[model samples]
Target: MVNLNAVLLISFLLFSIGVIGVLIRRNALVILMCVELMLNAANLNFIAFARHSGSVSGQAFALLLMGFAAAEVAVGLALVVALYRKRDTVQVDDINLLKG
Candidate 1:
Protein backbone atom coordinates (compact mmCIF):
# COMPACT_ATOMS: atom_id res chain seq x y z
CA MET A 1 0.00 0.00 0.00
CA VAL A 2 1.12 3.50 -0.77
CA ASN A 3 1.87 5.56 2.30
CA LEU A 4 0.09 8.92 2.34
CA ASN A 5 2.44 10.34 4.92
CA ALA A 6 5.43 9.51 2.76
CA VAL A 7 3.84 11.24 -0.17
CA LEU A 8 3.14 14.31 1.89
CA LEU A 9 6.69 14.35 3.20
CA ILE A 10 8.12 14.14 -0.29
CA SER A 11 5.87 16.95 -1.39
CA PHE A 12 7.04 19.07 1.50
CA LEU A 13 10.66 18.39 0.64
CA LEU A 14 10.09 19.39 -2.97
CA PHE A 15 8.44 22.59 -1.81
CA SER A 16 11.36 23.43 0.42
CA ILE A 17 13.78 22.95 -2.43
CA GLY A 18 11.73 25.26 -4.60
CA VAL A 19 11.62 27.88 -1.90
CA ILE A 20 15.36 27.73 -1.49
CA GLY A 21 15.84 28.05 -5.23
CA VAL A 22 13.63 31.11 -5.37
CA LEU A 23 15.49 32.74 -2.50
CA ILE A 24 18.97 31.97 -3.77
CA ARG A 25 18.73 31.99 -7.55
CA ARG A 26 19.48 35.11 -9.54
CA ASN A 27 18.02 34.13 -12.90
CA ALA A 28 14.40 35.13 -13.50
CA LEU A 29 13.54 32.10 -15.60
CA VAL A 30 14.96 29.68 -13.04
CA ILE A 31 13.09 31.41 -10.26
CA LEU A 32 9.86 31.17 -12.24
CA MET A 33 10.40 27.45 -12.77
CA CYS A 34 11.07 27.03 -9.07
CA VAL A 35 7.81 28.81 -8.28
CA GLU A 36 5.98 26.38 -10.53
CA LEU A 37 7.71 23.48 -8.80
CA MET A 38 6.52 24.76 -5.43
CA LEU A 39 2.98 25.07 -6.74
CA ASN A 40 3.09 21.54 -8.11
CA ALA A 41 4.38 20.21 -4.79
CA ALA A 42 1.37 21.69 -3.03
CA ASN A 43 -0.91 20.20 -5.65
CA LEU A 44 0.64 16.78 -5.12
CA ASN A 45 0.04 16.99 -1.40
CA PHE A 46 -3.57 18.03 -1.93
CA ILE A 47 -4.32 15.25 -4.35
CA ALA A 48 -2.60 12.67 -2.19
CA PHE A 49 -4.57 13.67 0.87
CA ALA A 50 -7.78 13.74 -1.13
CA ARG A 51 -7.24 10.20 -2.31
CA HIS A 52 -6.26 8.93 1.11
CA SER A 53 -9.21 10.55 2.92
CA GLY A 54 -11.84 9.42 0.40
CA SER A 55 -12.98 13.03 -0.12
CA VAL A 56 -13.19 15.07 -3.31
CA SER A 57 -12.74 18.49 -1.80
CA GLY A 58 -8.97 18.32 -1.80
CA GLN A 59 -8.92 17.19 -5.40
CA ALA A 60 -11.22 20.02 -6.39
CA PHE A 61 -9.06 22.52 -4.58
CA ALA A 62 -5.99 21.11 -6.27
CA LEU A 63 -7.63 21.56 -9.66
CA LEU A 64 -8.52 25.13 -8.83
CA LEU A 65 -4.98 25.83 -7.75
CA MET A 66 -3.73 24.33 -11.01
CA GLY A 67 -5.91 26.72 -12.99
CA PHE A 68 -4.56 29.68 -11.07
CA ALA A 69 -1.04 28.43 -11.52
CA ALA A 70 -1.55 28.29 -15.27
CA ALA A 71 -2.75 31.87 -15.32
CA GLU A 72 0.17 32.89 -13.15
CA VAL A 73 2.58 31.22 -15.55
CA ALA A 74 1.09 33.08 -18.45
CA VAL A 75 1.45 36.45 -16.75
CA GLY A 76 4.87 35.59 -15.38
CA LEU A 77 6.17 34.62 -18.81
CA ALA A 78 4.88 37.84 -20.27
CA LEU A 79 6.69 39.78 -17.58
CA VAL A 80 9.87 37.85 -18.23
CA VAL A 81 9.67 38.62 -21.91
CA ALA A 82 9.12 42.28 -21.20
CA LEU A 83 11.97 42.44 -18.73
CA TYR A 84 14.33 40.62 -21.07
CA ARG A 85 13.44 43.00 -23.87
CA LYS A 86 14.09 46.02 -21.66
CA ARG A 87 17.27 44.91 -19.91
CA ASP A 88 18.60 42.07 -22.09
CA THR A 89 19.22 40.10 -18.88
CA VAL A 90 17.15 37.92 -16.55
CA GLN A 91 18.73 38.62 -13.21
CA VAL A 92 16.27 39.75 -10.54
CA ASP A 93 18.89 41.69 -8.60
CA ASP A 94 19.59 43.85 -11.63
CA ILE A 95 16.00 45.06 -11.71
CA ASN A 96 16.28 48.09 -9.48
CA LEU A 97 14.65 50.71 -11.63
CA LEU A 98 12.09 51.65 -8.98
CA LYS A 99 14.72 52.07 -6.32
CA GLY A 100 15.36 55.58 -5.03
Candidate 2:
Protein backbone atom coordinates (compact mmCIF):
# COMPACT_ATOMS: atom_id res chain seq x y z
CA MET A 1 0.00 0.00 0.00
CA VAL A 2 2.88 2.32 -0.48
CA ASN A 3 2.31 5.38 -2.63
CA LEU A 4 4.20 5.68 -5.93
CA ASN A 5 4.99 9.31 -5.30
CA ALA A 6 6.56 8.47 -1.96
CA VAL A 7 8.64 5.70 -3.46
CA LEU A 8 9.81 8.00 -6.24
CA LEU A 9 10.73 10.67 -3.73
CA ILE A 10 12.74 8.22 -1.66
CA SER A 11 14.51 6.90 -4.71
CA PHE A 12 15.36 10.40 -5.83
CA LEU A 13 16.77 11.24 -2.44
CA LEU A 14 18.88 8.09 -2.40
CA PHE A 15 20.20 8.82 -5.88
CA SER A 16 21.02 12.40 -4.97
CA ILE A 17 22.90 11.29 -1.90
CA GLY A 18 24.86 8.80 -3.95
CA VAL A 19 25.80 11.49 -6.47
CA ILE A 20 26.93 13.83 -3.76
CA GLY A 21 28.95 11.12 -2.11
CA VAL A 22 30.64 10.22 -5.34
CA LEU A 23 31.46 13.83 -6.02
CA ILE A 24 32.75 14.60 -2.55
CA ARG A 25 34.59 11.40 -1.65
CA ARG A 26 38.23 10.96 -2.60
CA ASN A 27 38.60 7.23 -1.99
CA ALA A 28 38.04 4.85 -4.88
CA LEU A 29 36.23 2.34 -2.69
CA VAL A 30 33.85 4.98 -1.42
CA ILE A 31 33.17 6.07 -4.99
CA LEU A 32 32.36 2.50 -5.96
CA MET A 33 30.03 2.19 -3.01
CA CYS A 34 28.32 5.39 -4.02
CA VAL A 35 27.87 4.00 -7.53
CA GLU A 36 26.22 0.95 -6.04
CA LEU A 37 23.95 3.22 -4.03
CA MET A 38 22.94 5.02 -7.21
CA LEU A 39 22.26 1.72 -8.95
CA ASN A 40 20.08 0.56 -6.08
CA ALA A 41 18.14 3.80 -6.24
CA ALA A 42 17.55 3.23 -9.94
CA ASN A 43 16.39 -0.29 -9.20
CA LEU A 44 13.98 1.06 -6.63
CA ASN A 45 12.62 3.43 -9.23
CA PHE A 46 12.23 0.57 -11.69
CA ILE A 47 10.37 -1.60 -9.23
CA ALA A 48 8.14 1.27 -8.18
CA PHE A 49 7.23 2.21 -11.71
CA ALA A 50 6.69 -1.42 -12.66
CA ARG A 51 4.26 -1.85 -9.81
CA HIS A 52 2.56 1.42 -10.63
CA SER A 53 2.06 0.59 -14.31
CA GLY A 54 1.25 -3.12 -13.91
CA SER A 55 4.13 -4.39 -16.05
CA VAL A 56 6.99 -6.80 -15.46
CA SER A 57 9.52 -5.28 -17.86
CA GLY A 58 10.76 -2.68 -15.43
CA GLN A 59 11.32 -5.32 -12.78
CA ALA A 60 13.18 -7.47 -15.25
CA PHE A 61 15.38 -4.56 -16.25
CA ALA A 62 16.05 -3.83 -12.62
CA LEU A 63 17.19 -7.41 -12.08
CA LEU A 64 19.52 -7.15 -15.02
CA LEU A 65 20.87 -3.89 -13.73
CA MET A 66 21.66 -5.56 -10.43
CA GLY A 67 23.68 -8.21 -12.18
CA PHE A 68 25.52 -5.58 -14.20
CA ALA A 69 26.26 -3.60 -11.07
CA ALA A 70 27.65 -6.68 -9.40
CA ALA A 71 30.02 -7.30 -12.27
CA GLU A 72 31.02 -3.66 -12.33
CA VAL A 73 31.81 -3.78 -8.62
CA ALA A 74 33.90 -6.86 -9.05
CA VAL A 75 35.91 -5.30 -11.84
CA GLY A 76 36.20 -1.97 -10.09
CA LEU A 77 37.47 -3.57 -6.90
CA ALA A 78 40.00 -5.61 -8.75
CA LEU A 79 41.30 -2.51 -10.43
CA VAL A 80 41.50 -0.69 -7.15
CA VAL A 81 43.45 -3.53 -5.60
CA ALA A 82 45.83 -3.58 -8.49
CA LEU A 83 46.29 0.16 -8.36
CA TYR A 84 46.87 0.09 -4.63
CA ARG A 85 49.46 -2.62 -5.00
CA LYS A 86 51.30 -0.72 -7.71
CA ARG A 87 50.90 2.82 -6.42
CA ASP A 88 50.32 2.31 -2.67
CA THR A 89 47.25 4.48 -2.76
CA VAL A 90 43.56 4.40 -3.67
CA GLN A 91 42.86 8.08 -3.56
CA VAL A 92 41.30 9.34 -6.79
CA ASP A 93 43.79 12.19 -7.13
CA ASP A 94 46.86 10.20 -6.16
CA ILE A 95 46.67 7.46 -8.77
CA ASN A 96 46.82 8.23 -12.45
CA LEU A 97 47.10 5.14 -14.61
CA LEU A 98 45.67 6.87 -17.65
CA LYS A 99 48.17 9.63 -17.97
CA GLY A 100 49.10 8.63 -21.53
Candidate 3:
Protein backbone atom coordinates (compact mmCIF):
# COMPACT_ATOMS: atom_id res chain seq x y z
CA MET A 1 0.00 0.00 0.00
CA VAL A 2 1.12 3.53 -0.74
CA ASN A 3 2.02 5.59 2.31
CA LEU A 4 0.12 8.85 1.90
CA ASN A 5 1.26 10.28 5.17
CA ALA A 6 4.90 9.77 4.32
CA VAL A 7 4.43 11.42 0.99
CA LEU A 8 2.71 14.40 2.58
CA LEU A 9 5.45 14.72 5.15
CA ILE A 10 8.16 14.65 2.54
CA SER A 11 6.36 17.22 0.45
CA PHE A 12 6.02 19.49 3.47
CA LEU A 13 9.71 19.12 4.20
CA LEU A 14 10.68 20.00 0.66
CA PHE A 15 8.45 23.04 0.74
CA SER A 16 9.97 24.18 3.99
CA ILE A 17 13.46 23.77 2.62
CA GLY A 18 12.51 25.87 -0.37
CA VAL A 19 11.12 28.52 1.93
CA ILE A 20 14.34 28.60 3.91
CA GLY A 21 16.43 28.86 0.76
CA VAL A 22 14.39 31.81 -0.45
CA LEU A 23 14.66 33.47 2.91
CA ILE A 24 18.38 32.90 3.48
CA ARG A 25 20.01 32.76 0.07
CA ARG A 26 21.72 35.85 -1.34
CA ASN A 27 22.18 34.70 -4.94
CA ALA A 28 19.32 35.38 -7.30
CA LEU A 29 19.87 32.07 -9.05
CA VAL A 30 19.51 30.19 -5.78
CA ILE A 31 16.38 32.12 -4.99
CA LEU A 32 14.90 31.24 -8.37
CA MET A 33 15.81 27.61 -7.84
CA CYS A 34 14.13 27.68 -4.46
CA VAL A 35 11.03 29.14 -6.05
CA GLU A 36 11.03 26.28 -8.50
CA LEU A 37 11.43 23.84 -5.64
CA MET A 38 8.47 25.38 -3.89
CA LEU A 39 6.36 25.02 -7.04
CA ASN A 40 7.40 21.38 -7.36
CA ALA A 41 6.57 20.75 -3.72
CA ALA A 42 3.10 22.16 -4.31
CA ASN A 43 2.80 19.94 -7.35
CA LEU A 44 3.67 16.92 -5.26
CA ASN A 45 0.92 17.76 -2.83
CA PHE A 46 -1.54 18.14 -5.68
CA ILE A 47 -0.67 14.72 -7.04
CA ALA A 48 -0.81 13.20 -3.59
CA PHE A 49 -4.22 14.64 -2.88
CA ALA A 50 -5.47 13.56 -6.25
CA ARG A 51 -4.35 10.02 -5.54
CA HIS A 52 -5.79 10.00 -2.03
CA SER A 53 -9.14 11.59 -2.87
CA GLY A 54 -9.59 10.25 -6.41
CA SER A 55 -10.37 13.72 -7.67
CA VAL A 56 -9.36 15.08 -11.05
CA SER A 57 -9.54 18.67 -9.87
CA GLY A 58 -6.27 18.51 -8.06
CA GLN A 59 -4.52 17.11 -11.08
CA ALA A 60 -6.01 19.77 -13.30
CA PHE A 61 -4.92 22.50 -10.94
CA ALA A 62 -1.49 20.98 -10.78
CA LEU A 63 -1.22 21.10 -14.54
CA LEU A 64 -2.19 24.75 -14.47
CA LEU A 65 0.41 25.47 -11.88
CA MET A 66 3.04 23.73 -13.98
CA GLY A 67 2.18 25.89 -16.95
CA PHE A 68 2.41 29.02 -14.86
CA ALA A 69 5.71 27.92 -13.39
CA ALA A 70 7.17 27.39 -16.84
CA ALA A 71 6.11 30.85 -17.95
CA GLU A 72 7.44 32.40 -14.78
CA VAL A 73 10.77 30.64 -15.22
CA ALA A 74 11.11 31.95 -18.74
CA VAL A 75 10.34 35.51 -17.75
CA GLY A 76 12.48 35.35 -14.65
CA LEU A 77 15.47 33.99 -16.53
CA ALA A 78 15.13 36.70 -19.13
CA LEU A 79 15.16 39.33 -16.43
CA VAL A 80 18.17 37.71 -14.84
CA VAL A 81 20.03 37.78 -18.13
CA ALA A 82 19.19 41.42 -18.63
CA LEU A 83 20.30 42.31 -15.12
CA TYR A 84 23.50 40.35 -15.49
CA ARG A 85 24.28 42.25 -18.68
CA LYS A 86 23.75 45.57 -16.96
CA ARG A 87 25.24 44.79 -13.53
CA ASP A 88 27.48 41.74 -14.24
CA THR A 89 26.34 39.89 -11.14
CA VAL A 90 23.37 37.82 -10.05
CA GLN A 91 23.50 38.90 -6.44
CA VAL A 92 20.22 40.43 -5.32
CA ASP A 93 21.77 42.94 -2.95
CA ASP A 94 24.11 44.40 -5.57
CA ILE A 95 21.51 45.23 -8.20
CA ASN A 96 20.00 48.30 -6.65
CA LEU A 97 18.61 50.63 -9.30
CA LEU A 98 15.90 52.24 -7.23
CA LYS A 99 17.98 52.93 -4.15
CA GLY A 100 17.30 56.66 -4.07
TM-score for each of the candidates:
0.92, 0.93, 0.91
Q: How does candidate 2 fare on TM-score?
A: 0.93
User: Model 3, range 1-100, lDDT digits (tens) per residue?
Assistant: 8799988999999999999999998899899999999999999999999999998999999999999999999999999999999999999988788996
Candidate 2 lowest-lDDT run of ten: 91-100
lDDT by residue for model 1 (1-100), tens: 9899899899999999999999999999999999999999999999998998899999999999999999999999999999999999889999998995
For residues 1-100, write the lDDT of model 2, one tens digit per residue.
7999899999999999999999999999999999999999999999999998999999999999999999999999999999999899999988666895
What's model 2's overall lDDT? 0.95
- What TM-score does candidate 1 reach? 0.92
Off by over 4 Å in 3: none
Q: State the C-alpha lDDT per candidate.
A: 0.95, 0.95, 0.94
Error of 2 at 45 (Å): 0.6
**Which residue window of length 10 is worst by lDDT in model 1?**
1-10
Deviation (Å) of 77 in candidate 3 = 0.3
Question: In model 1, which runs have C-alpha deviations exceeding 4 angstroms?
Answer: none
Clashes of 1: 0
